[model samples]
Target: MTTQHLEHPTHTHTHGPDCGHQAVSHGDHVDYAHDGHLHREHSGHWDECESGAHTTHDGHTHVHGSDCGHEAVRHGDHVDYVHDGHRHAEHDGHYDDH
Candidate 1:
């Protein structure tokens, strides 16, 4: 997986345990959910958490798409389906955490 390389410009608010935004674990880092998107602290700056490892959601038989009964969020290059308490994105014939 690769990072988007897109920095969130003029980001003044620091996200953390008490930042009010929901914290989601992404691979080896923590990303904060804010403004309908995910943000990660990187190199003293903030970037949209858009890329990561292709972790397959085993036993996930439900296909996510239009009218899939889940909230579809427009991500950088693809759509993520909100299920349970996390987001899932389709990649390489499986769903990965977004």
Candidate 2:
């Protein structure tokens, strides 16, 4: 019998205050950004922004004060990633939380 080798799943991520993957960023808002697809729960805005506004993450990652369940889709200036079917939509404003 011949022996075969199996490969392990690789995971390499880079996200932080100064992540280079960021395309458009302002204060705590990001747009047109696309990170690798690794199937993981990303961060998002959970609390109010004092201005009674709810932040959203289009097709990118966003860290929050607490853990948030945000996968992301094509919203606003965010990049489209419907190749595998996640969810997408376009708005007048950005839906990404820096």
- By TM-score, the best candidate is 1
Across 1-98, the per-residue lDDT of candidate 1 in tens digits comes to: 56577799888999999999867766678777777777899999998887545656778888998989987766656777778765788989888865
Worst 10 residues of 2 by lDDT: 44-53
- Give the per-residue lDDT digits (tens) of candidate 2, residues 35-84: 33212212431111111233455554433222344344423344333222
- Give each model's whole-structure lDDT: 0.78, 0.31
lDDT (C-alpha) at residue 62 in model 2: 31
Clashes of each: 0, 2
Q: Can you give the lDDT of residue 18 in candidate 2?
A: 67
**Candidate 1 colliding pairs:** none
Q: What is the lDDT of residue 46 in candidate 1?
A: 96
